[model samples]
Target: MISAGQASAWPKFAHILGHDEWIDMPEFQRVEDRVKNRVLLDPMIAEETSKFEKNVLLERLAEAKIAAAPVMTVADVANDPHFRDERSMYTEVTHPQLGPVRITNQAVKMSETNPYVRGCAPLLGEHNDEVYQSLGFTPEEISAWREKGVI
Candidate 1:
């Protein structure tokens, strides 16, 4: 990942970044232009990063002290012991119809209260009548909409 302050970090990436036109621009404008036009940077980073394993690149970035984070795959996050065991990032809950299912736990931990996923999400159109009635539609009108498949 490119640092926002590109000049200070240039020596490390100069070989890969090459002498691009933006290299000479002032720091603020360089950062602004990069953000506005990722076409200027993303391809280069992608090409360079592709040469290294993801974890190796992450380690190199950390060594350079450039703020970077990995875009984790589902399998990576699910299987990582730090997330699965230490932090309890995922947990199994009894889904009403599907039986036990694994789901993400809340990210925040608190001293006063514990929050969790209550249940599986409601089925499609599960609360149609209740929602329509609360919005002032009559039960008959809601049923008519359902029959017409307009819901």
Candidate 2:
């Protein structure tokens, strides 16, 4: 997302000049350079940079007067003209535990059926008994393993 400073500066300049002032900002040039460096020049730079390093880079970019777009939400995606035809992008599923859950179908649109969740996440060691039984272990053997801190 664009920094608060960039958002503030652009609007203020635009208001004063009665037109977009971002066209003349050196910060804009820095932003273009940063994007070009990250995306066009070396896309892998993003993977190389850690979260902390990325934040630091962004801070440096802000200091150099670069701007960015704000983060978009699901509503924004649904309303966007480019994605409007992809209405199946948003779908609802019946989760066994959570009841009706909204899931994104952005992956495969050809399938008309909504995805279904089998169940909630398993609790730690909840299936120990069942799994051990499936492996042909008797109740006594399972109890012995648990007592010996092996299970």
Candidate 3:
């Protein structure tokens, strides 16, 4: 647990990393001692407490909202201006191996433009020659580096 005075200096301390300020902090000593004691005594209790809290929150939320709740259609969501105008929903990128990859604009929209991947994953060193050449390295230099296990 951090003290009030020490917690107040967190922003200032975070900015001065790799300097002597971190070594001079009073909170650092207290935190280190607390961690050491916890590691030595009842480590399982700390692990169980975290899992218990997560389960409790999830159980409460599940009870509040039915597991078989009605699903919303794309039409229902698209009526909202925020979902309709989102730029991420329509963005697409071209991969050298995969051709054009269609990125989903909306998670809920299941349509033709948002089809699953049509190409296989790229093989190892698929663009090694092209990339090295683009970086102004000659073919002979790339071959030498490859032989020496550098590339």
Candidate 4:
């Protein structure tokens, strides 16, 4: 993968990336199959575990800054270099049961007030009691609501 900083300094990276090997999908022929069901069958059955059409090396697209890293899943975002660095977009929060947990930091910046993640994303019925308490429901009432499947 080409690092962002390197390619940002050189515009030639864009020209090179446009002509890379995996840019276009490999040619394939589709067959019409009908018996029990009608479906298009792929004659180009994949021998490689990886498929060319869906599995381009995102890390090799140097000019596009977003493509500098290997493909990251949703769960991988927290650990990605740009997200998890010293100056991070994610922060550590101590959840009551989950212990130290990661959560996304707020995107807004303000001088008068600030935005931040307060705790772990709540589990089912986790913050129900707290919300009920704020709404002036007693603990007993909150418990009754839980039993009644109100939350």
Which lDDT value does model 2 have at 89? 59
Model 1 scores worst on lDDT over the 10 consecutive residues at 13-22
**Which 10 residues in a row give candidate 3 its minimum summed lDDT?**
1-10
lDDT string for model 3 (25-78, tens) is 453435454355544423543343345445453454344342322234777554
Off by over 4 Å in 3: 1-65, 69-112
Query: Considering TM-score, which of the candidate structures 1 and 4 is the better prediction for this target?
Result: 1
What tens digits encode model 4's per-residue C-alpha lDDT throughout 10-124? 2333234342332222321111111112222122122221333333535334324444445568878766686677446887899888798767787665779977777777778
Q: Candidate 3 vs candidate 4: which has greater TM-score?
A: 4
TM-score for candidate 4, please give it: 0.39
**Model 4 regions more than 4 Å off:** 1-71, 74-76, 109-113, 127-151
What number of clashing residue pairs does each candidate have, in the order they appear? 0, 0, 1, 0
Question: What C-alpha lDDT do the candidate models reach, one value each?
Answer: 0.71, 0.54, 0.49, 0.50
Which candidate do you rate higher for lDDT, 1 or 3? 1
- Flag clash pairs in model 3: 89-105
Q: Name the candidate, 3 or 4, with the larger lDDT value.
A: 4
TM-score per candidate, chains pooled: 0.63, 0.36, 0.27, 0.39
Candidate 1, 33-128: lDDT as tens digits: 656667656776677678877787667767776767777789989998999998888878887688999999988878799788787788887887
List the RMSD of every prediction in angstroms: 5.5, 12.2, 15.9, 10.4
- Highest-lDDT candidate: 1
